[model samples]
Target: MEKAKEMVVGIKELSSLPAVYHQVRGVLDNADSSIIDLANVVSVDAAITARLLHVVNSVYFGLMSRVDTVSRAVSILGMQQVHDIVLATSVSAMFKGMSPANMNMTRFWSNSVMRALIARTGAEMVRAGELERFFVAGLLSDLGHLVMYEVEPKLAEQAQMLSVQSGRPLHELERELLGCDYAEVGAALVDKWHLPPRLGAAIAGQIEPALADELYRRDAAMLNLARIMTDAMEQKMESEAIAELFDESIWTLSGLKPANVATIRLIAEMNHGEVVTLFFPQLRPAG
Candidate 1:
């Protein structure tokens, strides 16, 4: 209890969002917003604009020519995708240079990007709506762990060890050991950050599939499969134990048959490097 309390108290109270990002995300959320609105908002931030242009032209998207401005990027990528890239880049920049002792920042973000990409791919495979926001939700689903690690590194480490030793999921171990789990913590973080309410709820409700809204249910399902698919891609324990998380309905709803699951897993692995770079560029330098 002491250790966990220490961890919780140790985290920074203010996780600042970049001003330009806040402005741009606000514009993106407005239904009547135009591409010119995005271009104007993003153009004000030179660094963000540069990053956006670079990402759109990256080999992952396979554009024939380079993009030089936010307007061109927005025209080609559309609003949702532009929103996703901006969010990812902005969030990455905000959290960059996070202290090494708090967490393996590289691996933590790498896992997040991998899960997010896989989830986005899986969700789109089934025609899930709000695909871009869903991708962001999937990326941030495990954000509670960042707080835990920052607040109480040792206890968070213990909880993680417990998860491994006991073969229970991390969230379950968190509830037992930390009084509250990462999902709740993550939800709290989301609320504090003033993100979309549904995004926070999905993170909060990820462990309780039955209670989640349709979007959250789909969001959780995407994240769940992504985690499993990542484990498979990494060649972790290929046991049926991990497969139980799928249950019956989740698998059927995802519309990925066992064969498709295998194919997706292979694709995720084969494209790991490109996928990681697509989401998190800083990691490549670290690696």
Candidate 2:
């Protein structure tokens, strides 16, 4: 764990979120801060403001009327939802132009968006509150791998290759080879960033939700299931094959049955392209 924390500390400058995000966070942390105050801070950053409006008006939100201004959007979505959107967009912007070795940025983000959508859909199925948090959690779940590829490209590549060839879990190989897995590294980064403790807990416990604190175990389990569904989609597995991948514990922890996999996956696939483009417009659709 110290090693993971150290790795995050070492790359603090490289992984830092934009200043505007911090400014928004500051407003949110203030008890007296109003929606207008939050909106004012967000409006200062033209790029964030534009992206926020775009997402607000996107089909995903399903708003009856278009939102032309940040303040109106803030009123409609409430403070927490707006903050989550800012965090998500800010994170996507942070990774722009970063081309990590041995990592395909396009494919990585694609899978991430799919995972996020699946998690969000699953959350809705379970009537889990804070649906946006689930989306952000899923989107950021694999962030440890990004850090690994940046800080330890060779070892990360080796672990990835060995996982593929040996048919072992990537995190297991990462633990053996790199002394820490992507989940730990990612959780460390989340803690370092001072993002919500729940987000970090979910990331850390994703590999083994049962080991997570009971408060966050359900979230961790949801992420684990999301990753499995994303992998199934990538492999083009049949619904039955995907169902075969889940154990009873996974179903219980996630509050989802194998029967739910197909619907969750379809929701993810349908939204994947649009959400990916919303976050990463620079990425051309793959052939």
Please report the candidate that would top lDDT against the real structure.
2
In model 2, the number of clashes is 0
TM-score of each: 0.86, 0.96
Task: Give a tens-digit lDDT track for model 1, residues 1-287.
Answer: 34333443455643556788788879978989999998999999889888888778877677988888888889988887887778777777767767548577877887787777777777677787666676687788777788787776677788889888988887777777677777777777766667778777777777765567775676776666777666654566453544654667667546655445655555555656776676667774444
Tell me the number of clashing residue pairs for each predicted model: 2, 0
Question: So what's the TM-score on candidate 1?
Answer: 0.86
Candidate 2, 155-250: lDDT as tens digits: 999999998999999989999988999999989988878898999999999989988999998899999999988888788899779989876777
The worst-scoring run of ten residues by lDDT in candidate 2 lies at 6-15
Local lDDT at 232 for model 1: 59
Model 2, residue 246: C-alpha shift (Å): 1.8
